[model samples]
Target: MRKALTLLGTGLAAALALTACGGGNNASAPSAAATLDPANPTTVTVGATPTPQAKILEFVDQKLAKEAGIDLEIKEFDDYQTPNIALSDGSLDANYFQHLPFLEDQMKTKGYKFEHGAPIHIEPYAGFSAKHKKISEIPDGATIAITNDPGNQPRALKLLESAGLLKDIKDDSSALTLSDEQNPKKLKFEENQPEILLPLVKDPKIDMAIINGNYILDAGLNTDDALVVESVKDSPYGNFLVWRAGEETPAIAKLEELLHSPEVKAYIEKTWPNGDVTPAF
Candidate 1:
């Protein structure tokens, strides 16, 4: 049987020791002297976004990690930026919330060196709207809201291009200004935090919103409701496990193995059917 998952929220600051199942008097007790032991039981702290990412990690910790001498500590972050920040600062042993494009942008722009594990899964990005029923209905000066995340903004523009509202442009070079010529509708863009895009799109004032897959799932809106969704098979936005460069340890390796384990794949497929979430491995 799977044990209950232990989770730490964003507010948690101090390091907490985690004891493997049946190794301590109380599994939930937090200890400050936690250390890693390759040959024996070890604790690993990972930062992750809630929903599927944290939930998936929780599953691995409960079901497979203990037997492998791995005790997983999951810290949940509400935003995309914090997980990487925590990972880079050594606050977290690893993080499992972002795709490669985002990782590249973080490393290139923020000057952080990190190493990532194998592809874990893809949370399809989608376009949603409250004002327009179809792509053609958008007015000439309509406003479109998108994630301000550097890696995701270009992706949102590409989705707009596919919807027949803009022209195709190279990836990673897109911005609000670049869309002027290709934009037949002369659409305006509002860049904000990814999570904020959901409510903004639902507003009658906003024409469309490009929301991240996990946020969409949390909103309880069906993917079919999206104005347009990215292709699952070819999407490059597969989320994975990432850690500080040159910091990979035995505990990290074991956790990575458990993430790609059959149990996780089955859990993802069963938890989210109809391609709402797809295993990238």
Candidate 2:
């Protein structure tokens, strides 16, 4: 099923609600940001979600821009659509909050005119441990758990795929919906809030599970027990910085270059570790 990750509950509803307030109607598609104008370095204001992106941006805000001779100002947004609207209305210079696929869905469904700069980093989704040590440790035909939400469902499946538990991903580069899984591991799914995934990881019957790094951190787990990890080298889910179409100011340009710089890559590796959130340069 072509499911959405963000349409889950009241918070998601409130988030999507913002697009209804502003953005745009079914108008012409927005243009992508062009090459940077080094002559006029602008102060770029960007909105970001916490995890890897926001944390990484702080490093750029601190270091890389000075060398590039640009000032990058970053704003933090918990909700997804607000940044897009801010970008559209000229409230913010740009944003670094979403993946390219999610951005496409947002623009097409909400009639948004958004575009992305260079792809930034990939946060590898991983099967975590609260109880089990390995996939084989998960009892045969045991009910491994996955998130019931559509947005996270595929990632859950992919974790199982890495473990040799889930099978039949027709095309690794494209989306892997549940129906595409010709053979599934003997895994059950949990519809619990993404935040509580760590607690559930302790349940004996729960077997194995998949979780995003932020929630994993929230649950008090780091890179200690990631059984099956997401592959950034050849996977399709690397994240990118999103800006309004044709809105490449000098500051945005500098931020893009900084994001791909050597220092930023090292910062991300140290922050997340073991290619969990690798720099996708």
Candidate 3:
């Protein structure tokens, strides 16, 4: 049986409500002035995935934020799109889940102007399988499941290529396809939302799935279960804190610095050893 992480029902509903509002809210962009006052810090609302992002934010809030006069109110989100939508609409003060490539793609396609802070950590993109123990065992005509978003599809394809499973993937390819020459095994590709991918790949119909690093630990799986994993020496997929292009404040900067502090580094090493989650700082 596949170990799939269960998302909070209410959280998903909230995210849906925010996303469903679309771009109809004509709220003007927030002022560029700092929202935090050192003498009287305000609570900053941030949207993040439940796994390591929210967990890390909790650590900062409990251990460091109070002393530094920073208050964080984390809003848990399961889907990637909803967080950015919330941030753009001023529903969230900030978000801490996406890497640069994903953020850039979202901005270009959706017209969201988001500015990111220093990276927190890198979640190694990995290939997992329920049908096969190893890549060599994959048969012809196998169906591979991967994320469907503009940001992740190409990265997933590149990961497959690295594993010697596919070829000719460009960095910005939005439309994913496979020709006979490019796919020697006659493999078929299926795309899905990131949140449901773990459960979706467990179906007998799917052969392999490429999952984001953030979702791996949450799904009760780790590097040990992945058929193939990305190298962490200098990977480009470090997840970072992001906000409206000009809405970044001192509190946000403090959070970013705390994320790279020695205490957080020690916590990451203790929590996810064996190169599962590498601290990007």
Candidate 4:
């Protein structure tokens, strides 16, 4: 049997490791120093977001892990920052929530030694609103809630530009800040933590919010409800599995194999029929 833990709030203190089944003495131990034995089922503790990330892992744990000799344990995180923090501190064997750009930013800024597998899926970024049905409905000088993280803020801004809300955006492959030159409508932006952007958009004062597809799913909001959805065609924002450098084991390899298997791809397509989450492989 597998286990799941929900981590709310920020910081390393909130990222308590969950015990995996059959992990007797090493239940609370980190996988960094564990020995790899191909004959035995390896217990891998992975951190992920609550929606499609954890759900996808749960599917693999229940249906595919045993035959592949992998014992999966999943930890659910509400925020984007904590997973990598947990991984860096040896709290998780791996994580499966971020894309290449976000991972690159984290590694460069924090000096994390990490490696990742191929892109597993894409959670299309989109603009959402509770008060407005379309982008044209947003009035000038309206406040729009978005993620404050540099990794995703540019994505949100690009989505807004596609919707004709912003223009003349110059992204220099670095963390971008919104300026008056890009704000044609003079729309004010309220940047908050990614997890909070959902609820912030619901507020009457906030006009709209650009949120990742997973958060929208977790909140019971339909992807069809989004005012402007990011295109998946040739999109570089595909989420993948990540682990510490040189920590890969046979079990981890098996997990990665199962992750990109036809079963997982079919499962993703079947589960997220609305195209909120699509297989990238």
Q: Using lDDT as the measure, which candidate wins? A: 4
TM-score (C-alpha, index-matched) for candidate 4: 0.87
Candidate 2, 47: how far from true, in Å? 1.6
Task: Assess each prediction's global lDDT (C-alpha) against the native.
Answer: 0.75, 0.62, 0.75, 0.79
Candidate 3 residue 29 Cα shift, in angstroms, is 18
- Per-residue CA lDDT of model 1 for 22-123, tens digit only, reads 111111212223344535768788888777898898888787877777777888777776676677667788888888788777677666667777788998
User: What lDDT is obtained when candidate 4 is compared to the true structure?
Assistant: 0.79
Give lDDT tens digits, candidate 2, residues 95-175: 776665556656666666666666678776677666677767776556555654344555666567667876764332222
- TM-score for each prediction? 0.84, 0.73, 0.85, 0.87
Backbone clashes, candidate 2:
2
lDDT of 2: 0.62
Backbone collision count in every prediction? Answer: 0, 2, 0, 0
Query: Candidate 2: where are CA atoms >4 Å away?
Result: 1-41, 67-69, 78-91, 140-152, 170-181, 192-196, 203-205, 217-220, 270-273
Q: Which RMSD does model 3 reach against the true structure?
A: 5.6
TM-score of 1: 0.84
Clashes of 1: 0
Instruction: Please list the residue runs of candidate 1 whose C-alpha ends up more than 4 Å from where it truly belongs after superposition.
Output: 1-40
Model 4 / residue 33 / CA error / Å: 19
Best by TM-score: 4
List the pairs of residues colliding in candidate 1.
Answer: none
